[model samples]
Structure formats: C-alpha cells, structure tokens
Target: MRHIKEYDGLRGLMALWVLVGHWAATIYIQFPWPANLGNAYAVDVFVILSGFAIATLVERKRETYGIYITRRVLRIFPVYWFYLAISIALAWVSVDMWTNAAGGEATSNRLQISIAALDNFWPNVISHVVALHGAVPRNMVPNGEYAFLGQAWSISLEWQFYLIAPLVIALGVRAASSFKAGLVLVLGLFVLSYISPRFPYSFIGRYSAFFAIGIATYFLVNVGIPFLTQRRIVIAPIAMLIVTALILLQLPSVLPVSIWIVATASVLVPSQFGLSAIAGLLRWKPVQALGQMSYSVYLSHMAVLVLAMLVLEKAGITSTYLHAALLLIITLAGTLIISIASYNFIEVPFQRLGRNLATRPQAAE
Candidate 1:
C-alpha cells in the first residue's frame, strides 16, 4: 500500500498521449493508423489505472464505504464541474461559428463541438450533472458519449466504477486467496466486456476487462507476489505499446487488451529498477510534476486547443504547417497554465475539503 510515484508518471504519459492524439486531429494530420486510436488507447490506460488506484486506496485506507465514496465524488466532480462551466461558455460564445461550420460541406472540430453543445442542451446538462450522461443509450441521445465535454464520458464511467469498486474489491479479496477463484472473477469480467457494447460506449462494463486487469495487477504486486519485487517489468509495457501500434491496423480490437496490458504492467513494475529507460524516464522530476496535475491536463487540453485554433484562424495564420505549429505552442502553454491554476484552486481545495469532511467525527451514529 505504499504510494506509487510511477503510477502518477504513467498517468502523465497517458494524458499527454491523449492530448497529442487530439492535437493531431485538430491540425488535420492523418497518421497511417486511425487518428483517434491513440486517444482511445490512452483512455483505456486511464481506466486500468483507475482500477489500480481504487484498489490501492481501499486496501491502504480502510475507510468507511460512505467516506470513501464521498472522497471520490469530490475528487472527480469539483474540477470537472469547473471545466464544464468553461466548456459551456466557450460553446455559447462560438455557437455561430460552429453553426456556420456545420452548414459547410466539410466536417471539422468546430462543427462537432457545435452539435454537442446545441443538441438537447438542457437535457445534456441534467444528465451530466448526475454523471449519468455516459449511460444514456445512443438512441436516446445521439452521440451522448461525446457531448459537452467530449472527454468527460470517461469521467462518468470512472464515477460509476468508484461507486462499485468497494463491492468489487471485497469480492476480489476473497478471490485473491485462490487462483481458480481469481481466474473465475477475471473470466466473468471479460464476459461482461464481451457484452458491454450492447450498452453505451461509456458504460463501465465496456471497459470491464481493463479494470479487471488492473485489479489483478494489484493482487499480483501487493498481495500475491511481493517477493517478485526485483523483476524488471517496465519493458513489458513499452513492448506492448510498440507491438500494438504495429498490429492495430489489422487488429483494431486488440487495442483495449493491449492498452490494459501496458497499463497493468506499468503498475506491477517498480519505477526504481536499476535505471531501465522507461522506469527512469517515469521517475524524472518533470514527468512526476506533470503526473501530479494530469487530470487537469486531460480535461483542459481540448478547450485550449479549440481556443488556440480559433485565435489563429482569426489572425489569418492559415498556412497549414505554421498554423499547426502555432496552435501546438499556444495550446500547450495555455493548457499548462490553466491546468496548474485549476489544480491549485479547484482540485487541491476540494480534495482537502473532502479529506476534512470524511475524517470529521460522526455524532451518535
């Protein structure tokens, strides 16, 4: 139950990967592979990390269920709602441009943003408020997964997992004592994953295997084989990424599995493994700093990218490469600044508040 600095570093890497993937699309650069595939892979890594983190917290803190859930809600919501407000405002201000873009023949990020903002606005807001927007069936709310804050679908999914994690971990604890039992649990989760597409993309079950992998990782590293502490497992994730990248075009379905494997391996491996490249890179101070504010980076980067694109377009800096370069510079700078402020003001304060409230004594319960 020791704190894992490498997990933070890994989170930082995945967040930046997601940002870069989005940046590629924004700048209209087409890779040989599917453009948004990297983003999806990174998000899957996040799902796995969430599972691992939740397991770690449950095992280490042993807080009451109510207290744990309360802390999680506050951890996720305050900063999320802060950015939600920003996204709504930005959408409102740029509605006309979005509308105009929509009328054009070409599809662009602006048009997509406009559609997400304009369609069933109040309904979307209500669903998002309760963090149930991701569960709404697509037929009920077309493209609801990407509505409003496009990246937030995953946040809702994580919220769902937070609600259920204690129960799952309790079951997992029993299973951890028996290899066959643990295998059954994992198999059950994979079955859920197989059926999850019948529901919304943001449904927790859709990513069940990823979460299961993370949970299994926790059991491996913490409970089952702490003696394997000397094993150099960092190469596993790096190799997974490279192999998956090469084969993804032919085997797109391998993405979820591959990403989960990478993420889970990253957790099982220690960052202080005799100067391995990936492990050492993860332990670097700047990477750790980025990891610290990774949630802010993940949520705020898209908005920064959009705003930078708008400003550059207005300035008529439309040469393709120059525009892309400027957008990258401006967006990265803006995102870091906003994310730092948001982390300090919104995230840190709310997190402290959650801690205080959770630790406060109950009266006559």
Candidate 2:
C-alpha cells in the first residue's frame, strides 16, 4: 500500500494522455494534425493502468477479497460520485443551453438529457451511467461539435472494466497456482474483447483488448517476465508521458501515423522482447503525475470544456476556432486544477477510506 504511491504517477500521466487526446481532437477540428490521434485509446491506456493498479490492489494471492473490494470501492467510487455530481449539476445547468446548441433536439427537456436518446444523446443515461454503450453500436466518442459530452463514455467504460476485471482476476487465482493463471485469465478476457462484437461480453467493447493488455502487463511487471524480475525492471509511466508528448505533440511532423497508432503501439511495443525506451518514458515523473489523476481528468474534462465554451460564449466570442482554442486553454487549466484537487480531496480520501474503515490490519486487508 505504501509503495502504491509510485503507481500514482502512472495514473496521473495516463489520465493526462487521455486529456491530451481529447484536447488534441478538439484542436484537430481546427488544426488537422495527423487526424487519427483522437480516438479513446489514450483512455484505453488509462484503463490498462487501472487494471494493472487494481491487480496489485486486490489479488487474492496478495490480499483478502473483502478488504480488496472495500478498498477498490473506496478508491474508485467517491471521486466518481463526486465527478458525477459535477457532471449532473453541470449537465443540469447547461442542459437548456446545450440543448439549444444541439438545435435538432428538444432543448429544455430533462427527460431528453436524462434519457439521452440514441440518435440524439448517444446511448442515453442508462448505458452511460452503467458504461454499457460500447457493447452495442452507439458511437462512444462524440461526433463533431458534440465532442465534450462524449468524454464520459470512456469513464463509463473504465467503470465497467473496474467492476468486471476483478472477478476475472479472482477466477485466475482460484483456477491456477501461478501468474500463468492470471495470464490465461487475461488472455481469455482479451479473446473475449476481441470477439466482443459478436458475443457482447459486457456493456462495452472499447476496453476489451486494452484492459487485457493491462492485466497481462501486470503479470509481466509484477510477477516478472520470466527473467526480467530477476533484474528488477519497471515501465516508467513518466517516460511514456514524455515520449508521448514528443511524438504526439512536439514532433508530429516527424511523427506520422496517429495517436491511435501510437496507443496501439503503446500496447504492442511492450510485447517486443527487447530494450524498451518508450516504456521507460511512460515510467517517467511528469508523465506519471498526469497519469495519476487521469481518471478525474477523464471524467471531469468534458464538463470543463463545456463550461469553458459557455464562458467564452458569454464573453461575447462565438467563433468556433476561437471558442475551441479558448476552451482548450480554460479546460486544460481547469481540468488540471480540478483533477489535482479532487485527487487530494475526493479521490485520495475515498480511495483511502477503506484503510481507515478496515476492521482488521494487514490481516483485514
């Protein structure tokens, strides 16, 4: 638990990657940088990190199940509910205006906002709240000017992944004796995710392959990849952050393909049995910090964008580009502040609640 602080860096960094992906996409509407960097894979990276982190947190081999679930709830739900508070409240206030912005849909109806009609709201509240929309055909990401609201879809996916992955992990512990069991479980989940379109494993499929990668990575890292643990290796999420920035931001001219490619590469690159520079970067400091609050950053970023745009609109500026640029600045600043603050207040507190509330010590855990 004490060393978990080290993982915090990855969480913040991955979360930031997600934020950058979102911000990049928003800018792409005006700037056109490589064009493929905007998919939810950066969020996928975050999911991987979440799975990796939770694997460490709840492994029955490592800790008791009751303490594990309680700790997980404390870690995941409070800030989640708090952010939901932020989203619901912001959604409430902006509903009319946002509805007006949508123009094609009913503007003032709570039913519309709450219901989130497929054609109009994209999976509505039920799927959104439960993180099930990705299982079906609904576009989990937003379309065009509708970008801000779509960010929540990843949160939904993350939430659902959190719920189901533990069960899969626990199964591995019961079914097998070693990390090999975990690998089978993770690969099985990956196979499930790969075939999700046909079978519909959970509420969504965006996280299928990504979550599996995280699980596998956990085994590889924590259990040591055959001989790697003998050498005491690590991923360095902060380094990943820096490399991600350089490749995605500083040198896109030199760096072609897309963030989508990069994200997939993030997963695949690790599997290569050689020296890993990018993985080392992912384990970097600044990158790690962004990864830590990445969850809060993902969940709350859209609201920040929406709020920023609204503020810009009220400030008498209506140009889409200007609004977007201003929105980016404001949203980035606001999202970072909120993410850090929430991590400290809501996220940290709740994530730690189980520690304080636990009936036993290490034994309870």
Candidate 3:
C-alpha cells in the first residue's frame, strides 16, 4: 500500500500531544489553551486513525488474512514487547525502592508496592502479556500505575482492533453493495457505544463509533467527498478550528464521544483532499521522521517520564514548575533518542521480516 505522509505527520503530532498530556498530569504543569487538551482526546484520534489506516490498507492491497495479520503483528509487537520488558524491569526496581524507602515507617509507597504485587500484579501482567487488558475490567493495579505501563491500556485496545480488523473489513466489503446493510452496520456500532458505559474496559463498545467514523471517512474519500475536496486553505483552517474548539472546551461530560469522532474526521478527511501547502507542512522531512518513530515514542515516553521523576526526586528537585519542565525536556529528548534506536533496530528488522514472510507464496496461503 502507498504511504500517506500527512497521516504520518498527524501521528507524530498526536504522539507529542500525548507526551505533553502525560507531563501535565504527572507533574501538574498546566499549559495554555491548545496544549492543555486532554490526552484522552488524542487517544481517540489515534483510534480513528488506526481504523482509517487499516481500512485503507485492506482496500488498496487486498492482502490475504494471513499476510494482514502478520503485518500488523510485526508492526506492533516487537516494539511493544521491548517496552513491556523495560516496564517490568522498572516495576521490579520500583518495588525494591519502595520497600527500602519504607524502612519500618508507614508509607504509601510500601502499601502501593504490596498491592501492586500481592493483589493485582500477576493478573495485570497476564492480561497485558496477552494484550487483553483493554477487555478485562479490574485489570489495573490499586495504585493506578497500571502495573507500570499505564498508557498501555490504549495499546491493548489497539491490539483488540488489530485482531478483529480482518473480520471488520470483510463485513464492510460484503456490505458495500447495499447501503441499507452499511447503515445497519453503522447503527450497530453506535448501539455498542451507547451501552459501553455499562461495561468497563469495553474498548470496542466505547470506541467503535470513532472507528466507524474512520471507516466511513475511508469510504467517503474513496468515493470523493466534494466538501472535503475543496481548497486546502478552506479545509485546513476549518479542521484547525475544530481542533481548537475541542481543546478549548475540554469536552464537557455531557457531550458524547461522537462529537470528538466528528472533530477527528474533520481533521483527517480534509487533508486527503489534495496535497496543498498545509499538507506540505505535515509532510516535512522531520515531521515524517517523527511519525515513523511515533509508535516507539508512544510506548516509551511514559516509562521515561516516570524514571526521570524518580531521578529528579532523588536529586531533591522540589519546585513543581522546574520538575515539570525538566521532566518534559528529559522525556521528550530521551524518548526521541530511544525511539530512533528502536525504530532502526527493532521495528525495521521485524517489518522487513514480516514483509518477506508475507510475500512468500506458501506463507500467503
């Protein structure tokens, strides 16, 4: 399938946004306006983009299920497993530190360490190991560290989507002949979202609407939407405005996820209209490079932030603003460096392997 550089840029921007959001939450650094938008919103963008990317791939390549699955596994698992190992090691050290720091004194750290290991650690580990944590309620450790990879909950959700995408694509393809059938499918997804609140950790139920929006966008783009086909100057500003609104409002609880879905679609669909000046910005070499390493950045940034915080505390950095700034700088710089290495060493090799295996005639079968 052909590459979509603009989408790559979007992924890079979203990854950076997630890093910023984590910094805000972890260190209490409040940024002004657009920067303050919740990272959860960025995650929704990721979910939508994932659906779009997968749909586009299936539509364009028409690859066999085996090949599709292999491609996805290679794209996701190598970096994921690498980061998981690091997180596990970090958790081990954290537990030891907490135990030592307690030194017969009552401390939350000791309690957290005990709860993480004794109560929730094994189960959480099993869930995360199998990539089913997104579907399993009560998978989180008591201290909300999420067993050392708190951000991985979304990765788990993405894994679930990857597993089922072939079926979703098949269904979509089958329904293409009948608009009524497609509408029914879309409605079903909405119904799932409507009931998602009743089921904790129901990634599908909670995010299916966004994914549906993405799939719908793919179809719309394939067929050509006139409004989106407008000039980039017009579309780009509107998309930016939607994003800015999303940021400013912080999305009141009363608003449904569909609003964000629409906003995400607004941003993504227009960029595909045609390569314009705006697209040029997104396709800049550095931006595309960042996008290429986005997966690694996403998986590794939280761990980097946590480790940095621990080191900062050890160094007696008590100012919140200073801590926040230092954490941001360290996390961004460290994550970029680590991601660059990971992309070169882990991601590219596995990707090439997956491609080689998928292209083999017998493997495709």
Best by lDDT: 1
TM-score for each predicted model, relative to the true structure: 0.83, 0.65, 0.77
Top candidate, metric TM-score? 1
Stretches of candidate 3 exceeding 4 Å from the true structure: 28-36, 92-118, 139-145, 178-191, 226-277, 362-365
Model 2, span 279-313: residue lDDT tens:
56656777777766777787788678667756765
lDDT of 1 by residue, 1-365 (tens): 56777778888988888887777666644567756546787888888888888888888778899899889988999899988878877776556544432121223655764676567788788888878887787777776666768889899899888898887888788785878767876887887777777667899888776787677678777755555445633455454566567576666546655645544455455443333465667768988989999999999997887788678767877567787688789988999999999999999998998888766764325
> Mind giving the per-residue lDDT tens digits that candidate 3 earns over 190-245?
77777766544536777776676677767766654555566334444564465567
Question: Which stretches of model 2 miss by more than 4 angstroms?
Answer: 1-10, 24-36, 92-149, 173-195, 198-206, 224-285, 318-321, 358-365
Q: For model 1, give the RMSD to the true fold.
A: 4.5
Which residue runs does candidate 1 get wrong by more than 4 Å? 93-95, 98-113, 176-195, 227-275, 362-365
lDDT of 3: 0.70
lDDT (Cα, 0-100) at 347 in candidate 2: 82
lDDT of 3 at 20: 80
